[model samples]
Target: MRRRRLRALLGAALTAAIAVPLVAVAGDASAATNSFRGVNWADARDNYVNGWVIPSGLTAADSYSTVYTKANGIIAGFQSLLGANTVRLPINPQSVNDTWWASYKGAFDSALAHGMKVIVSYWEADTAKDGYVDDPAAWNTMWDRVTTDYAGNANVYFEPMNEPFGYSLSAWVSLCSTWLSRHANIPRGRVLISGTGYNDNVTGVGAASALSGTLLSLHFYGFWASDTTRAAWTTNLSNRLGSYSSRTVIDEAGSPMTTGLTYTGAANQDGNVFTSYFAATTDLTRARQMGIVYWPGLRTGDTYSITRQSGSGLAVNNASGVAQLRWGWGL
Candidate 1:
């Protein structure tokens, strides 16, 4: 997740109203972007680990059955509490290409068993948080195993890498193209190529003929700018997408959910930055008919986490945050 970076607003205010028709255009076999009503299930450690990754609420010593049961409850809470139909999880070389993988599959299997779509994304280890793949050989090997296991599962999606800021725009596109070539058996519709620069922009990747049929990933946050208006926030996100909104998924948009910010009523009039940001994001995503996966749906200690561990189960930390998310999903 691109935590904080303040940049100037792109241009003069664009209209808050998105004039695009809500007609559902089919980009891939999956139908439309709205089909993915999702939330990111991030590790409490922020998914940037030096060793094996374990999502919050799951221990390193848990068995396959234990992982399954635990993941099922969390996934169930996501669905029941937030109307989420998809869960995006993080993976790494250590997490996927080790003995722990046997038990980890249980989490993936349980999500699939619940009829929820799973987006498995790669996160660079913290030892080298430079946004480049740590080791090409190990990276490919990890993907080889991951794609081999889930290539046949229609509900599973693969993201090449998360926020690859280390590569230039051209280099990132080249890397994504290489990934597509390596895993050609996986349908292009099932692959999500992240935008260049912390997954912030998708126009370059979307226009690449080599990545035509693939989906795009975008991450937008309120802290990226000091824009205080709904129109500015909407324009900020729209500028990053360009003409690829149809194939783009705003998979990592979030703000402070537990800080007692009201998401209801006139958002522009709220005056709080987070309220305006959340309102503009949800409204714009809904207007564009795009998929939105909130960041850190269950990350412990994160104020942005919408849900928290309540005993053995999960409880919502912010009902209004979820309501705004559901509104974006058009639920």
Candidate 2:
């Protein structure tokens, strides 16, 4: 009788072990299917060829001022032409003390007005005493304020920091985790963690996994000086990051080095090099990993501005560049 009872107990334990795995597998499959459900621009036709740059200013009323209206119009025009659904705006944490919020608020409002998604970046400053890196408490406060102001708004994404290279990988991971934990009240899928490398390549999957539900962001600007370098970088990145297979986005990328000059002369040639590099990178297999955001749509003093020269009459002559972006890749 004792031997028979032990056998039955062992059999019951074995059955439960098998059942547990089956149930766990089913749950994982279910979760995978729902991973990207309801995320904005997830199924959009175009690969995310979003643009980034500083707005002309934060103040001018729509349709009234030349500078502000033109800045707003340029972005609106791009969305109309390209069906771009996202825009990345870098927010200097130090500038929050001044009218930076007011200046950018209009642009953010305009993006919403035109049905475009907004990704706000918290950038570090060189000399500022109160930037995001300078004060942890202030950073949290700013995040709270922004989220409170724009909470429940559609298609708005938050990036806690922009290219936090000075901090160790572990430190960055910790900082991002803390920020997300503190803002648990914010709507889900609104905050993203961005890293910088050759192409925003994350150093460790462990670090990436720490981000619970936020998007993984990266920046890639292969040698802006030459197309060959750009191509190599793109291929390297694709190979390195292809295996992760997580929800990723190229938050900033472009080839031609922008110097706040006319679109013609040496600048035009450099821009073409960038365009060709983009074309080559998109053709690679890794391009399928996630969305690609082109850099600097209308801002000057950046390498990836796509709009025409600020005061020069020369129209942005890269129609093919724009066309390639619209036709290539999936966001």
Which candidate ranks first by TM-score, i.e. highest?
1
Per-residue CA lDDT of model 1 for 163-240, tens digit only, reads 777776667777888999989999999999988767877766777777878999988888767777788888888888
lDDT of 2 by residue, 1-331 (tens): 1221222223222222221110111111011111111111110111111222234332223232343354466555556545466777665444344444555566667667767777776755434412136567766777777777777785787878765544545556678878877878765466666653222454342235566455666555444234444455456556434433254666655544344332222233234444445655544423453555666554443334455444422135355555555543342
**Candidate 2 off by > 4 Å:** 1-54, 57-71, 128-132, 196-199, 203-207, 224-231, 240-242, 257-276, 284-289, 301-303, 309-315, 329-331
Candidates' lDDT values, in order? 0.82, 0.48
**lDDT of model 1 at position 61:** 98
Candidate 1 local Cα displacement, residue 3, angstroms: 6.3
The weakest ten consecutive residues by lDDT in model 1 span: 7-16
- Please give the distance, in angstroms, between residue 195's alpha carbon in candidate 1 and its true position after superposition: 0.2
